[model samples]
Target: MKKLVYSILPVDGYYTFSQRFLELLKSAVSETFDLSAVIAPLESVFLRFETAYKRERKSEYTAKLAAADEARDRAYLALRHYLVACSYASVEGYKAAADTLLSILKRLGWSMQLASYQTESSRLGNLIAELGQEENAALLTTVQGTAWLERLMTAADAFEAIFQQKLTAEAADTNTSAYRLRKVLQEQIEMSLSWLEVQQKFNPSDKLTTLIGQVDELIAHTMTTARANATRKSAEEEALEEE
Candidate 1:
């Protein structure tokens, strides 16, 4: 299997779903991107441990730290990868490498989805305003009710998954899409808050909560749909193998 190994910088709560999805992604990529894991930083606490240990008598912990650094270095060099640094400590000369790694993530379909939501919505709203005055806005709003809405929603789902992990670097979303979309929606919600209040549609808190709820529902539905699709694909592949 072609492997795409991740030596994620450890942050509290980040590894859980990423580790799992790495496996699933590998399966999907088949000969393209095999997934593997090494010790990622458990948290920013790693820096403290490294500093303290370096100050004290060198011990196994120090060795482990060194190995982690080395393994982290080797892992990045080994394949297409993404590194999320939780600490501000520079990797010295590796800044270029880090940027390159991030670019690889972009190529691998890991991008912040928040930009699209704003750009698309604004363009859509403008288009509606141009088409007519009264009914055009309503029609544009109703476009969300159509069949292809699900596909865009699925893309949003993918955004959330990437954003969750990529956003905070710790205790974050395992699904990258979930992370990305939540970030985008949060931005949108913030932008719309004053308008919502002015229009008396909802209080700021209520609007915030509503947007959060929508994101949550989108994530849930996306996960269910992705799982069903995976199951169906596996079944079909197995049948083909048997034939």
Candidate 2:
């Protein structure tokens, strides 16, 4: 019975709202009542919207990125510890070999992983280049650490590739795509309801009443969610300002 408050619904909340609406009308929809054609096209858009949603959220894409970064960090730590642990090696030149590499690492002051994605990538690249220099290459060879260097390089490169993928996905207008799709669904739902309302006036039925009631429930839930999100965002902003 109630109309959708489209603007109040957040971008992330729009897909599920339309989805629930679709399930409600699936049995009763027709060319007369829902002439706005809300089902077939909506199903198609859902696929794209789902992908955009994943890209926009910190779920699948972000999880993979995080996993890659963790792997690289582990590789880096392994290499670092190997060099440091060799400082007291029983072999004569092992300590000297480690000292050569440790001097390079000591200049870093802090782990590059503590930096931002791009910053860490750049620093790690630079560190790898410095370690691969002709003179340092001999020291790496002496300590049997060329394999360690290769592992770090492999891990860092993999992380950078995933980071670049995340960047590309972000640059591909995923947010805008999601917003545009949500708006289309919202408009179609409202238009479909208008036609259904007119049909109900000419030919009253309990079916229409039940369908309207379900839609009203969805609207109520969506409104409550929007209001809660707004309140949370406001509180967060206030906290940041106080800080």
Candidate 3:
């Protein structure tokens, strides 16, 4: 029986048994004991050591998982805030937004969704390049300014698409889609305001101002039309219930 138990003892268990055997010999110099007496205490010491090691290992693993989870949450929040900042195209605001995005990219570089971050970063770089070109022009002609605006708008659309994809992944519901649509519209309006401010400062002209006004009016009309449609649909549903 003793040989059978020894054959199955793990390496660590054997080490624990040897250490306990020395302690037992020192503490019981005059005592006479059978093999069972020594084996019992050795087994107890091995079990205690094994339980403690497992508990400590579990604690370390849990701490690592918690830290990872917190990092992910912080990265997500930073991304959202960066998008909000990017909606403002002032020179100072744009720089700040870019910095925020770059920081998030660096922190989450090893994330499973690294490709998504890279795509958004590339879009932001393109937008910044277009803005730089506009700034460097000696006199931004109407056609040239319009071209820059178009490029920025395209980049904004792509950025919004990426953001929507993230939102959908987090909350795959009808309300999530509606919320994303509203957010996109809000971002467009904010971006238009920022562009208008730039044109007002550097390329002041009635034509550009009128164009910006028309864009704002169009957005307002679209919102009014959407609300009316929703109201009509609700009434129709109520009438059907009455019947």
* Candidate number of the best TM-score: 2
User: Model-by-model lDDT, in order?
Assistant: 0.33, 0.71, 0.41
| Winner on lDDT (1 vs 3) | 3
Best lDDT goes to which candidate?
A: 2
Reference-based TM-score of each model: 0.19, 0.49, 0.24
Give per-residue CA lDDT, model 3, range 76-193, as digits (tens): 3334333445545565445554544444435544222222233435544553454346332312231123344344445445545555554555375322222223233333334434
Candidate 3 local lDDT, residue 173: 35
- Report the Cα lDDT for candidate 3: 0.41
lDDT of 1 at 102: 39
Question: Candidate 2, which segments miss by more than 4 Å at Cα?
Answer: 1-55, 174-243
Full ranking by TM-score:
2, 3, 1
lDDT of 2: 0.71
lDDT of 2 at 216: 84
lDDT by residue for model 1 (1-243), tens: 111111121221123333332233234333432212211222222333334323333333334433333332232222212133311226553444344433533543332211133343343333323323444223323332222323334443443444343335423433333323333333332333333234334433444344434434533544454455545644553444345
Off by over 4 Å in 1: 1-204
